[model samples]
Target: MIYRKDRKVLKRVDFGAAKNSLMGVLAALVVYALVIAWGRVYEAFQLETLLVGGAVVVVTAFRLWLVARFDALYGAGPARWRKLFAFGLILHALVWGLLPAWLVWRVGTGFNFFVVILYNVGVTTALGSSWMAGLKVRQFYILLMFLPVIGALFLGGGLREWLLALLVAAYTFYLFRLYRGQYELFWHAVTRERRSGGAERRRELPASTDIQLSLVYRLAHELRTPMNSVMGMMSLLEDTRLDDEQKEYLQVAGQSGKLMITLIDDVLDYSRILTGRITLSPDYFDLRGAMEQILEAFGPMAQAKGLELAAVVDRLLPKRVRGDRDRLMQVLTNLLSNAIKFSERGEVRMDVDFTAEGEHDGVLRVRVSDQGAGMDTDTLKHLFEDQFLDGAVDAFAVRHTGFGLLVCKGLIEAMGGAIGAESVEGEGSTFWFTVRLGMQADMSESSKLSGAMADIQGVVVGAGAGSLACLQEEFEALGSQCQGARDYDHALQALRAGHREQAEFDLLLVDTHGRRELALNLCRNVLEDPSLRPVKLMLMCTIEERGEPTVQRLVDKHGLVTLVRPVHRTGLRIALGRLLGVPRSQPVQDLPTETPEERRRRKLYRLLLVEDNEVNQLVTRGMLSKLGYQVKTVNNAETALALLDQENFDLVLMDCMMPDLDGFAATRDLREREQREQRPRTPVIAITANTAEGAQARCLAAGMDDFLAKPVHLQELETVLRRWLSREDDSAAEEPDSE
Candidate 1:
């Protein structure tokens, strides 16, 4: 009963503190008015000294009450107390110095100098000593000092006034030192408290390692699925007789691979709260234009999930706000993705509003609301906490990772704004965030959109002749300049020439249907060349089994952007818009790059091949030989390694999978071994089909430079030999070796 009573008393005290904060401000204002009126009354009765002293007392008391009220509201700590004392000193100086000076000048009283100086000293001393006394003692001291000062200035003689002024000045200096010393001690305590709290949080985090591991494991599994798809697509591309339809299917496979890579990157980013690393590289971008680009990316996924995704951007949202365009897209993507995932059948709506919320500061509020399964109060409460749902095992909800909210929170906070979620369980949830951005002054709508579009630079390489023509037509329609490059060498030359002439082309569209290897080679060449590095390369590939790996490598290795086979003019335009930093006006229509017969009419190449691996060598030799290539077999890199030393062959198909020397090391030995012995360099083709990522590049880097993926196709082998052998014949032909 006694403990309950004490708890009640403590609660009452808290309530009193709140009530006093509000009431005190009102009381102070009233007192200020009363003091002003009383001063006028005293002046009317010809009591000049009394009126001035009374006014000073009343004003000082009011200032003290206001400080107290602020403390009550905010809570009194060392920091608050120090601020209160500082404020007291400033108020005292204003009331004592300026008000008294003005009154003396107005009344023409030369004697008011002593009154002003005495009041200043007394107020300063009171402020300095305020923190030292107990509540009772402090209040008593205030009353005593103020009452006597009021009385003395009003009625005391000149000698007594001089003594009082001397005393006040000495006390004021002493009190100043006291207050300064106490403030230093208070700050030290605060620093220690913060350090202690941080240590405790660190301790708590390590204890939750099990929870952390679970989340990391799940995320890794999710990422691997896409990676595997990319790998599988790469393996399928070795088929020799893939028709146009088959190629189209592969192109879609490659697009899926690209999407998976992006998804993995985003998921990892959401997992790690490195929000500060997401810097805003802001360029001019239109509000609706940016949304359209994001919408296109999400459209297919939303459609597949049977979700209706819609956007409603208010015209008031400044058509262009200075911000990181990619980051904004990321923010929108995260929001839309989450909305779609959570919503079962209802719609996901994105509404953007621009409003001026502060002095010279404009705010863009993007509210992404969904008519989905709303979260409960508890879930919403813990939404942004990093570890709040770290241990959740529910696969459905876990997919969202709650990390998205954390990222959203960090981004909004970094942008000088706030993000919050409101939900009513089983009803719906609305997630909204605001960004306070400085409005761009003097930018017209068209200029803003044009400025945004102008930043993207596109480079299309190796587009099939037909696709190249189609893309050119589309470019002409869009008033964009199009340049064509037939092969890797042509693309590199064009890129170099453009760089040399300082010609600016907004987009580079490359066709990769029949020329996937050539296109990839060109992309690698451009990326490797320092001179052509400025051009943003986009690969246009037909649907083929190998499209996934090829696209993945293009994107991962060369940072190449891709548009799958059957190019849509609208998608191409938007991609150009995004890459070029243009505001998108409309979605590009999908246009088939190559007709069925056009793709079939492309030439196929065959070659005499040699490989060592019983499984790989037999499979590859059989596959290529079956596809119309005349293949030769060697048991090990040593035999082919020896045979290459003696013979001139159409193409010395070297196997990296061999004993005595591995394919890479053997190739190096074959290429450099000849260089060391002063023999002419033979074009050694690598035939080991290793599915490992970066395996082919590693083989080329080693020396027997040309690569044909394992289970080699007759056409790929033919293409590989055609490229190197043709180059050789143009210079000097060598005789074939009898193995």
Candidate 2:
């Protein structure tokens, strides 16, 4: 029994340290061959040489034993394995250093075949042992095992050996490159494991526990701040003494708050999905209605960014389908979001098509296409893989967590659908997915209509704030009733009382200023309450202070609408019109309908271009000018500041990522000067491609209004200017000094 128990334990240890043991043995054999070679050449096997050789064997054995012991004791943590491997490496060096080559050569009879074979076997075994212990060891071990064989063939005497040597050398070079690539991959995995923690017995328990707790804490805190902001803005909105402009500004604050709450919910849901805790609740619902709702949600974002967004549904499809409405909407929203994010100058097209089944049934196909920076086959293959963003070492490239596509895939697959992508590098990409659902025979007849009529009520919040007054005016002028909020408290009180008081607002909007927290809280309270479940909420804010996770949560949770700060009147009006079911009096061409040339033209704007380097200035000027923008050039912030004081440019294109009077300091000075002299605040848009960490927040905090990363695409510049310029005129004109 005792022997059996010991054997069992040894088996377990052997299973764990098998790879390392093999590597040690192989290393010992290589040293043995060298020793024999030295012995034969020198014909001397002294006591000192024997002691060194014995020490080499002893050290190798000891190191292998230590590794096995450590793994048995500590559960073979990666760190412990590394330490043991280092010791083995030391033993290898010692063995090679102390071996008596002359004695080996003499005893083994110059180039003894037996010694060579034994040494090769030993070295191969040692290397193979180490390789086998790894996660994906088989392939690597085979490669390593073949290396020595090739080396021996190359080193062997004779014409055949010489020919084999040439082949071996070529193979060796290839293997060397392969090893370098694998090492990079190994290092990447190690770093990721260190950062995200290991996946093993206790993997999810501790690391996930911490992540969950941290998320909960962060959500609670972050949600509260935005809630407070919304509440405060609503409170101020109730103050009748405030002027229309002030009221408009307060309304903007309220809108921003609502957006914050929406973002919070999105992040929470996403986190839940990440933790494998998201439960899909499927129910029969109107598929068209769901698509319309999603479009309405993202309409504001697309408009705010000056991007054209449109959804086309084939009339032959059934209006209603049985599925998880929320998950389906999420998939659509994610696809649309990606389309909008990547596209610069062109329109994002979303089309729904119906594929007929054998007789009457059919599948619903949704396709989203964008003329943005599309991916190559290589990128597309890894698009949905986890930790893909870490591989994007370039700063200027668009960053993605790879979570969106993965979630989309999961949701679609769960709903019995297939999703895929088709793309051409640099041209465009189209992501399409199909959902199988039982079609309603009777309902299919109604689908002959051009577009489904949507009954949407537009409720404009924060109409009292100066920045949003024009937006409010635009919405009202379009025949939608605009509700104004001055602060968060007033908005919450109004939201809470509106239902009871027989006064109902279909949409809530808040600005993100002092009322950011209030707006977010109001959204949470409203969304969580069953009584207030019907009302849709929207938020408008600068992403300057918030992290991606925060924004993602809000978007995932509450079906909240987000309009980035400094939205134009047209964009705001169109979004509100679309959401509230108000007909757009002006038939503006949708983005998807616009040609590339038209897009370029529409995207052009007046830019206050600032650059210190003459060559850079010239390069930028030529680029912007070619893109059809009116460029106002300045060599430094001083000149840019003077130009701002003297002229009303569409946007102040500042070089914040510059040297000397760097962008941040210059922005601070500009804001300070504007406030001190009572000058209208110009929107200083930072033109930088620098991912030099923390530059974005610093720019925003320093009072620079907006940012556009460097190697600036004309489309990006156009979008920023169109949004910021419109808001600039409203905010800038509202300043007391301006009057």
Candidate 3:
């Protein structure tokens, strides 16, 4: 068995060693007592016998008392008691060691007297050897005690005495070796335990599929809990003063963590679907808005591969549709993810079209097309089957088709949709699904929305023919007339010609591709010309160019706008609006400055946080406090209930997994108490890493008001709080005045 040096293990060893020592001392005392009893029974009370028996009784009583004392105090005063115990052993050895020699010298070689004295000496020597017990210092005491007997044997000056001395030396050597072996064994176990600690004892055997799924789910939750803290703290760090390079590094770290969390979520989702526990919750949502978010989330992943991600929604499509928004998002996300994962270059596009429409119901089709390595006929034939991902895929490797696709198909089917794929073996693939959804009653709001960039004339320069065409389409959709030129010189010549022809341009768009120096040279030329000075300049630069001194000089020092390449339309539109000095026709809600009321509300919010993990508790508490909430933490549910009984709280953030009285039980009990006591229910929100399909339903059924998956984003935290915290329960506590 693997060993650990925990307190329980150490205590067992120490007590066992202490008991062995005590038993040796006790045995020595018993021998001395027996000698005294024999002397008294024989009625031989000579002065020498009296003195010897009296000394024996006195030493025996003293040693008995010492053993008792050692036993009493060893646990509390190990260092002090050990020394006293060893000293008692030495005294017993000395009395026995010298008594035999004294008896030989005094009793004139009497048979009975020699028998009694040698018997006592022999017993004491055996006890001393056993008591040595691997301690070098105790062995020295044993040797010292035996010296007198050896000296007495030599003084006798006979072959018998010499033989006795030789026998004694041989026994001593054997005892030394025994003690030395014990010493090595004990220390080896201790050192090994110390080095391994408690962690190494975990089993190393591979787990079965069910066990693997359980472990993956658990690991996903545990890992994401801390990663959430890391990403949250990194986001907070951005508000501090960091240079471009430092910020870039921090951003990369944050992006990696986000990617890891996404992978974990995929595993969690697949596990849920595998167990037949997943359920879809349908609601009305903005179709275009959801698509926009999907594109935004995957923007970095696509850009990393030099790929463009595009989302196309038919204008006639309903603005809001009733369906499982989250599930639909998951389906599209999985498809897009696989698209990006297998593709090296080119654009990954999502197309949303209405196959059929009515006032109440409509058929919506979504196709995710990617220029990636396509599937063979055999692979396509078994795509959605249960065994598709069974044996062919490695558990730890990046899979081309497996559980993720399985989950996507299951989710789509659950939502009353059919999923299919079209592919060419060497070219690319398109995966599509169609679902029925109800249209929003009010389509006027959707029709009222207008392009943000109206009444603008823009010119694009030096983009690849394909990219340039896409840029033109994006700009034209925004009600701007966009002209493309073949290259840099051609664009500059066209601009000069426009100036000569008295056609003044409103905006100048430049695509740097990857050459910073070339882009900078062109920028300088445009800035130097008086005719093009009024034409607002915006550069679509690569990720590396954002940190360049030349680009920084142009943006910060010279006031030019820069947008990173493989641009999403949202970012592009925002850049163009900023350059043109006009807000979008749709009111864009940027991060707002805090109002006085908002500050007041933030200060008044109080939260009770219940969690068992100390690290998660500390990090989450810090994050919540940083958001301006007053937070009190308890390690377990029992303490939480006790605290809630004594004081009032605005909300409680409960952790589902905990030792003794978990969050679910605590929430249930609280609800019962509220009912019995005729009091209003205080809002309890579950914050957990468990993302199994029914986790939220379980939380709500157990009387929690809401559930938040672990590693909650700051924005998500805000949204949840806004939804639940708005209902001020005066029965729990008076709402803070907005004065």
Best by lDDT: 3
TM-score of each candidate structure, all chains considered together: 0.32, 0.32, 0.57
> Of 2 and 3, which scores higher on lDDT?
3
Cα-based RMSD of the predictions, in order?
35.5, 28.0, 26.0
The alpha-carbon lDDT assigned to residue 155 of candidate 3 equals 79
Per-residue lDDT of model 1, residues 1-739, tens digit only? 0111232323333334333334333443443344346435344434654655566566557555654565464454544543554454344444444444344335422234343343444443434322432233333333344434444433444543433333333233333434444444333222223354566676666544444434543444333432432333244343445556445544654564555455545544544444233344556666567786776667556645655455555544555667767767777888888888888865566766788665344878888777787988878887777553454542212323455566677666766778888999887899888887766555534433334433344455654443455465555544444666556676677677778788755455666544557767776776687776667666665334225776677677756766654444445655565555666555698665244432222212224355443334444555444434455677766666677666644456766555567777776777777788888766667655343335567877987657765334345655665467445332121122212
TM-score of 1: 0.32
Model 2: per-residue Cα lDDT over 542-651, one tens digit each = 54423455555777876566665444433554555454455655668756623564335434446788877453465456555555567878888877777777776666
Positional deviation of residue 541's Cα in model 2 after best superposition, in angstroms: 27
lDDT of 2: 0.56
lDDT of 3 by residue, 1-739 (tens): 4444444444444455445555555565555455446534225445665666566566666656655665567667766665665666566667667765665455423343344444544454444424433377556555655667667766778654543444344334433444454454454434434345444443553334565467656666656666655565566656656657556655765776677677677777776666665677778888777777777678767877887766666656666888888888888888999999989977788777875466777898988888888898888887776652455642222224656788888787777889999999768999999888877866644211135456777888865554565567667656667887677877788788878888877677888763556767888899877878877888987666678887888787668888765555567767876776655576778666265655557667778999886656766676677677789999999999988888888889999988779899999999998899887678999999887657799999999998888777777777787677767643333254422
Q: Higher-lDDT candidate among 1 and 3?
A: 3
